[model samples]
Target: MKKLQVLYIAAFFAVCLVPFVGMAVTGQESSSENRTLAEFPQLKTEEGINVQWLNDAGEYFQDHFAFRNELVTANALINGKILGTSTASGVIQGTDGWLYYKDSLEDYLGENLLKDRSLYNISHILSLMQEYLAEKNVQFAFTVAPNKNSLYDENMPYYDSYKVSDNKNLINLQKYLKNENVSYVDLYEPLAKADEILYHKRDSHWNNKGAACASDFLLEGLGKEHESYTDETYTVKTDFTGDLDEMLYPLATTPEDEIYYDRQTTFAYVGEVGSNFDPRITTVNPVKTGSLVMYRDSFGNALLPFMADAYGNAYFSRGIPYQLTDVDTMVADTVVVERAERFLPEMAESAPVMPAPERTVSTGEDKADPEAVKDLEIITQGNYLKISGRIAEKYLDTESRIYVRTDGDKVYEAFPNDVTLDDGSTDCGGFTLYLPVGTATEKGNLEILTGNDESADIIFAKD
Candidate 1:
C-alpha cells in the first residue's frame, strides 16, 4: 500500500514536469492569438536589475508553455460546444454557431450613441472631404458597412436589462449627412433585404456575394458605369476560415463556405502584394479607363477585387487621416470612403489631413471673450499649417462652423471635429483647420471665427 502511494506521487510529479520537458525539447510554439507572443524575460536591463522580471516571466511562460494551443483549443471546445459560450473575450457566442465580435456589441444594441455634436462633426468632416474632392473634379461617396448583428440580430442572444435603442449613431449620422449635402450610400437596406445569407456565420465581415452587391450599389452612387454581376457564375467553396473563428478556436478546424466568382482576373498588382490588410495597395486594370482612390477598412478586403476590376488605376488605403491628396497625385476620377457602422465614433476622433476650405466670413459681431477660446495652437505640419483649439461649449452649436482668419485676411473654414491634445485627452469642443504654409509669413496675428460671427484674436510666431 505504501509503495502504491509512492507510485502515485511519482506519477503526479512526472505529469507536472512533462510541460517543461516538452518545452525544452520542441521550443516555444508560434502564437495563434493574432498577436506577438511575449519574449523571454531578462533578469537585468541597462538601467539595472529588472524590477518587473517576475511578472514578465509569468507572462512569457503563459504565452510559450508547451501544448498551450492544444489546451486552449480543448478548453474553447468545451466552453463553446458544450457550455454554449465563448472563451475569448473578444468574441461573443451567438445562436446557431454564429460568433459576433465583442467590439460591435455597443453598436449592435444601439447603446453609447454618439452625441449630437459628434454626429454633426462626422457629417461636417465628410462634407469637407466631399468639397475637397469636388474641387479636384473627383466624385466622392461615403458608405458604412453595417455591423454583423445589426442586420442579423435574430441570432444574437438577449442580454438581461438591455434593449435596442431607436436612435443609433448610424441613423443620426445619416440625417446629418443629408442635411450637410454629403453623398451617402445606404448599404444597410439592400443588404438587409437580400434573399440569401450574405455574411458568414463566424466572420465579422460580409461574404463575396455581399461585397458584389455593395460594389454595385456604390458604383451606381458614383454614377460610374460598371459590369453587373447579377448572373455571374460562382462556386461556394467550403475551405474558408474566418478571423473570429481563429480567435475563438485556434486549433479547431471549422471552415465555412465562401462564394468565389469564376470571372477571369484582369487587374494586376503594382508592387509586392501582401494580404488585404496592407496599409496601401495599388492595382491597375488595362481594360478599364477611370481611376479610383478608396479609403476603406477591413470590409474593403472583399471589395478590393471588384473595385480593382472596374478602374484603370485604383488605390486602396487602410490608413487614417486619409491622404485625400492622393486624388490629385493619382489623377483619380472618383473617391469613396467606406467605414463600418461600429466605427462611427472614429469619424469625430481625428481630423482628416487636408487643406481647409477657404471661406469669406463676415466678422461683424462682438469679439469673443478672451476665456472663450482655450489652448489654441498653430503648428507647421509639412507644407500645411495645423491650427487647432477648443472653444467654450456654450458658444458652440450643432451647426456652428469654426473658421480661422490669417493676418493676411485669408479665412479658412475648420472641420468641426475633436482633436487629440498633447496630454492624450480629446477636446470635444475642439476645431481644426489646415492651411497652406504660404498663407501667412513671419510674425502675425490670427483670428478665430464661429458661425455666430464671434471672433477671437491670437498672436502667433512662425519659425
Candidate 2:
C-alpha cells in the first residue's frame, strides 16, 4: 500500500514538471554559442505569409531547444569517442584526444581554391602599392602566416591520406609574390622546428610560442634581433578553452592553457584608433626608427607588440574591403601586409571595394531619398534583373539596404556586387546589382526598395 502511494506521488510530480521544462528550454540566448537566438519572423504588409516563415521558425526552435548544448556535447562524445568517426560539427577526432577542424584542412590543402589571375593581380597591386610607398622611403612586405594544419597535420588521424596539391591558391600566390619581387616572409620553417606544440590543440590560432616565433621573424626581417626583455613580461593561465572546441562541445568547455604577454615601450600618443569597420591603429613607442603600416588579419593581434617595439609608430588595418586611399594616407616608413593562407583570395579584389551605390543605399526609409540612387537602369539577363546606377558615396560604409518584392508574391534581397569609384573620395560613381533570379521573369514587374528609396513596380522585360 505504501509503495502504491509513492508511485502515485511520483507520477504527480512528473506531470507537474512538464511546464517548467518547457519554460527552461525556451531560453532567450545561449552564452556558449556566442550568438543571439533568432527571433520569430515579422509580418510584412508588402509580402504576405511565405514558405520561408515556417522554415525560419523551425530553425529558431531547434537552435533554442531545451538542453541544446548538452545534447550536442553528448552526441559529439558518442560519435567521437565510441564510434571513432568525425563529428557532425566538422571536428575530426585525432589521436590522444586531439581535435582538428576540417575547415582548417580545407585551407591548408588548398581546397575550393581561388583563381590564378586574381592571385597575380594581387601581386601587381602590391607592386604598385609598394612603389607608392617606396617613393616615400617606406618598404612594403607581405607576411604569409602558416595554417595550423600545415604545421601540425601529423596530429590528424588521416593525415597520411591527405594529398598535397600544387594547384593550391597559397602555392600559386607565393610563386607570384616571388616573381613580382614582393618582399615577404614565411613563418612555417622556424615554427615547425620548435619542439613544443606552438598551436592550441583545440583552436585554429597559434599559441604564445607560435606567435613569438612569428614576431621573431618580423624583427629579423626589419634587420633587428628580438632581445627586448627590458619591459616585456608574460603571465600564464590554465583551464582555457579554444573557440573551435567551444563550437563543437559548448557545454563541455574543453580546457587548455594560455599565456598573455605585455611589452613596455617608450613613446607618446599621436592619435586615437580608427573606426570599427576600418581599424586604423597608430601608437607611439620607444623605438624612434620610423613608422610602419601593416594590413593584417587576426594573426596581427599577436604580432603587433613586436612591430610596435621596432618602429616609431605602427598603423594596422584590415586587408579586405580595403581603401587604396587609406593605404596611401596612412603613411609609414615601412608597409607590411600580413595575410593568412585562408584569405589569399582577398588580394585579387579591387581597392576601396566600391560596391554599387555601395551596399548602403536607400534602405529602410519609408520615403525615397532623391540622392540615394542615381542614373538607375533596370535590365534583364538570363533569369536575373540587374540594377545599374550611381549611388551616393556616403552610404558605402555600411551594408547595402535594398529589397526586392514581387506584388503579392515573394521578397528577396538584391546584391550590389560590382563598383567603380571615379574620384575615390566620398562619392560612389558606379555600381551593379543582381536581383534574386527565380522571382524575376520577362513577363513580370518587380518592386525595388533601396533603403528608403521605394520604387513602383517596374517591368524587367526588354523594351
**Candidate 1 wrong stretches, greater than 4 Å:** 1-22, 34-49, 364-377, 419-427, 441-443, 452-463
Q: Write the per-residue lDDT of candidate 1 for residues 1-463, one digit (tens) a residue.
A: 9999999999999998887888999899665675678999889899999999999998998898888888888999999898888888888888888988888887766777778888889998999999888887889999999898878887786661165675678887888999989999999999999998799898999999999999999888888888977799999889888888988888895999999999886899999988877889999999889999999999999999998899999999999989777888889989999999888888898788899888765665655567778877878988887888787777677778887777747778888877567897666678887877888643576667677335423322222
Q: Supply the TM-score for candidate 1.
A: 0.90
List candidate 2 segments past 4 Å from native. Answer: 1-26, 31-39, 86-90, 107-115, 164-168, 224-236, 260-282, 286-289, 327-330, 350-463
lDDT of each: 0.83, 0.60
C-alpha displacement of 266 in model 1, angstroms?
1.7
lDDT of 1: 0.83
Query: For candidate 2, lDDT tens digit of each residue in 1-463?
Result: 9999999999999876644486476654364553566876665535776658778877776666566677778987787778766554556667666676665566556565655545555665565556556666767677778777777777677653466663556666777778778777777777888778888888767876577778777767766534644245777788667766787677776688887776554655457644322456666776566777777887776666666666777677765655434545655667778877666654454432211221222224344356655666767654456655654544433333344554525554343333324664222233334454554554565444543235322212122
Q: List clashing residue pairs in candidate 1.
A: none
